[model samples]
Target: MLFNSSGFLFLYLPFVLAGYALLARVRPRWATGWLALVSLFFYGYWNVRYLPLLMASILFNYWVAGRMLAAVAARRRRWLVFALAANLALLGYYKYANFFIGSVNALTGAHLQAWEVLLPIGISFFTFTQIAFLVDCYRGLAGEYRLVHYTLFVSYFPHLIAGPVLHHKEMMPQFERPPGLNAADMAVGLSIFVVGLAKKVLLADPLSTLAGPVFAVDAHPQLVEAWIGALAYAFQLYFDFSGYSDMAIGLSRLFGVKLPLNFNSPYQAANIAEFWRRWHMTLSRFLRDYLYVPLGGNRHGRYRNLMLTMLLGGLWHGAGWSFVVWGGLHGVYLVMHHGWGALAGQGPPRCWGRMLTFFAVLAAWVVFRAPDLSTAGDILHAMVGGNGVALPHGLEAYASYFPVGCSFEGIRWIDFSGVAMPALLLAMVLAFAAPNTQQIFRHYAPCIEQLLGTPSCLLWSWCPHSYWGLAFSMLFLACVFSMNRVSEFLYFQF
Candidate 1:
């Protein structure tokens, strides 16, 4: 049921879109119901066992929200607290129970058996989405909604699996409007989707191959290997997650809905703070508003709160100490950025800021991609030439940084030596230079709203002309031809 799979691309999507177009004009409710059922089907197709869990979650939250919407202030607080607790308890048990048990077993010599519970797909996303709804309800922000409309919003296929963490206020009204098949919307959505699919199929997937071997559990890659692998993975994730977001937004647009902008050109960010603003932006905003603000964000002990938020945010990504370290590194980066800003009036020069911020991010991503803390340390050590400097090819530009006596003649741990370097460099160029999906379709307001102020003129814009159509059609063909081995999006694991 991967979005890239032919089954989804050809069969499931076509059928769903056709049905919605047929019903939406006169029977918008039916169309909404149709989408809800299809979304559920899409989820269940991955794992039937989790279908009930998802249903139960939706029903409970809907009921709790309804109760909150009707209750007195005191009762509403109780219901909101109860709802938050229930949602978090479910997420914790499924996502963190094993991590907790393992930590306990390691620390105190307790042989606590790990629970065999399988983590449900998109548990973190759906749970957080509902948690936001509950909090808004408590804040008297979330208004009442029919059960059917709520169901569709929660289960909508485009943002269901991986998300921009849709807010009730943002999405509920869209569902209230009659769903229709607009040709203009379809053309724009399809163009955006084709570009996204090309990004994943042509760029992200192949880059994964370049990165995979270097991060093997036993492979202790050297300086050149490490940098190439690290850059490959960094760019890989950039395209993979952003590509998925583009596809999600475009698909939703086909239904005459625009999902919030999730991934802008984060690599273009000149500082860690700017990076957070651009990367997984909804999640960062969630951490800011829901977690940080509630925790007295920048009001009392700003640095302390920032660190705690990042540590928790890192752990939120996965059940690993490496993830914690990843979060912690960013936390430190932010703290330093803030501290420096206080001493000086502003950040470093723009060029210097971009370079420093990139390597800083590159270092953190090493930890994020590692199998464990030990492996992460090993990779970082190699990255700095700790494990003897050697060169398979003449790839080193910073060779003077190495010990003077170290000989670097011939060592080749890297595969596809000739192809790898060029591919990686080209990928970096694309990541740093290419116009993102939003910019490409900016003429049409490709997202829920344009988060970016103006589209960069680095690339051509999407237009209603046949040339645009033909170009997108060619891109579509390229993606389709290249989808020999369909792979799950990297964010799907989260």
Candidate 2:
């Protein structure tokens, strides 16, 4: 279930939180078990059939890890290898079977029929999590697995779908600790969730309104529309994915788990190399540890390492040529940036390099977002002065699908475009100029220290932290209003 939905926000969350908190003081073990059961229910709430798949995978991995750990025979390494392969085989069959078949059919002109396999939600995430666990077990890095902890690790609903990819070490301890409700921490969690909600529903969805029409043009429209769409999409994706990440982080925090931060305002990067370091950082980390480092990393030839790393990284996103090309393009950009930096003997300062890097990355996102090579070419052609026609008259038809107004005549003079402009500009400034809102608030560490230190504030149970109280109330109201129009999270398909 979506984190921002009404059923989740009002019904599921409140009921679950109350149930969990109520059980925590009296029965901590039962509380965790209940959480796992609730999480399973949450998963089943989406599609009941998929629930068995999730449980089977979890149970399979748990058994495999235990078997691999208990093995004493020298030849039994093969069993561990077999188990790892089986886990990967499950992932490969379910996620990549059709993709592989389609590729084979396309390349060889063999009339191979692609199998219709329905991808289970969060399969990619759970697959990776389990694979990592099995690898750790074989390596003797993890201790004996417990059923309760293993179940909780796999089924925790907060980061279940799109993830920061929790490691066993990160999650196990939290399950060991009591899952009590801390009012101070709970308030912080709710605030972050609301902010994330606003980022997705309010800002990201409206930006899509502008972005959708421009991209719908088969040929590019005016340079104005082209830039608007490209820039708008760049921001739209930032807020959308980052919004989901924020919600994931926030939700995890409520349960007293600290997920790794996903986005660091990647648009602020001074170079493509830096951009990758900032964007979808967990995925980058996964590639570095699991893929890039294993593929000889930069320890070998610098250029080869960069290319291979990016190529595999691209392939990891999907089994498509476009994704491969997108990865290759970034790979090339990084190589060029590195070569240039070496020649100059230093990197550019944050401001100048960041703007150039933002534009370079923005240009590349056009390729990433385009449907295929031809569409990407068309977009690039338009960007470089391909004389395309004006946008069609009914371009604003879908604008009314959102809460935003369509035309100036039926609505107030302020159009949807006008309404979103201020938010758009604010997002741009935040993307470029400031540290993220979190880092900015973190600057107030000393004031927070003094307030808690004060004699008068301690006695009252109802006293709220001023900044959090103000910010989250505004965010909560905004998210409530924003969700009145439904918008899909950008990463849902992936």
Candidate 3:
């Protein structure tokens, strides 16, 4: 069930939270078991058919960890390899089977029938979490925990779908601790949740309308059309994914679990490297420590390692060539960033870096959002003025001086009279200038703080006084009004 849905926000969540809170106070062991069960139920709420698959995955990983821990040196390595292969094989079959079959059919005239393998929600996240767990176990960095704790760590409802990608060491200990509801934490959690819900319903979904028309264009868009669509999508993705991350953090906090920070203000980042550090942070950490480090990292050919990690990372997102191109472009951006740093001996000015980084990301988002290479090329061509510029009919005299393709009343999709451009401008301001959810809630230490480092950009802090309470009350009311059209978080596809 989507966190934004009324069923979850109203009925399921209240019942589960109340039960968990009471159980934690009375029977600690039962609290843990109860949470694990409800978490499983939450996953099942999406698709009951996949419940067994999730359980099987949990059981398999737990057993693999056990076997790996019990073995000798070579045996442990062997078990680790076996477990990794098994986990990957399952993921590949489910996530990539159709793509593989389709590609083969296109290339060699082979009519390979694609199998009907429905990908389980959060498969990528849970698989990666378990893989990291098994690797840490092999390296003696992680300890074996009880089955219930392991189950909860994997199945926890907050980060289960679109995730911050929980680490075992970060989560398991919390489940092992005695459960008691904290009033301060609960308040912080509700406030964060309300803010996130507002973002998703109010900003992200509406912007999707602008982005939708632009992407739906059958051919190259006009210059203005391209920018409108691109900018609209850039912010739509920012709020959609960012909103989900905030809700995840807030929901986990309600259970007294502080999930690692996921969505910082990535757009404010002055460089591509800094962007990665800010966006989808736990996934970046996993890729760095698990994939990049294992592939020789910078100890060998740094550029080559970057390409490989990003390529695989892109593939991990989906089974499509568009994703590969998106990943490949980021790989190039990182190489240029590092290459520039090495030669210049210092970074670019903050303003220059921030603008350049944003444009670079904007270009990459076109590819990421496109259905294929052809569509991406069309959009990029238009973005570079291959299509022409569109101006209002009254500006004909001014348009004649341009010495380029200029047309009046060329737009057929974007509606400026509506909330399109206004909302986009608002989003741009909020993204670049505003403090993020973590910053606004920094005073409460609502999320894991050390990873985000010191709060260097706090415009304001949250206060628990009546003024703030009334403001949040109106914000919450606005959130409820916007919830009339509930939608799924964008990251769920990954």
User: Highest lDDT, which number?
Assistant: 3
Clashing pairs in 3: none
1-494 per-residue lDDT for model 2 (tens digits): 78878889899988888888889988877888877888899888888999999999888888878787888757347766887788778878877898889889989999898888887778777777777777677778888756988898888888778776778887887788877876455545665676678888877887876677666637454554567677778899899888888888777777777777788888878788889889988777776777677678777777777888888667666667767888898889889998998899778887889888888888878877776767776766766656342333455665655434223223211124465666777778767776774674454322334335554332111233445444556667778876876766877656
Clashes of 2: 0
TM-score of each: 0.93, 0.87, 0.94
lDDT score for candidate 3 against the true structure: 0.86
lDDT of 3 by residue, 105-133 (tens): 98999999889888899999999999999
lDDT of 1 by residue, 118-197 (tens): 88899999999989889999999989898888888888898888897988888999898988987557766777787778
TM-score of 3: 0.94
Tell me the lDDT of model 1 at 104: 97
Clashing pairs in 1: none
Query: Could you tell which candidate, 1 or 2, scores higher by lDDT?
Result: 1
Lowest-sum lDDT 10-residue window in model 2? 405-414
Q: What is the C-alpha RMSD of each candidate to the true structure, in Å?
A: 4.9, 6.3, 4.8
Per-model lDDT: 0.84, 0.74, 0.86
List residue ranges in candidate 3 displaced over 4 A. Answer: 217-219, 393-404, 444-464
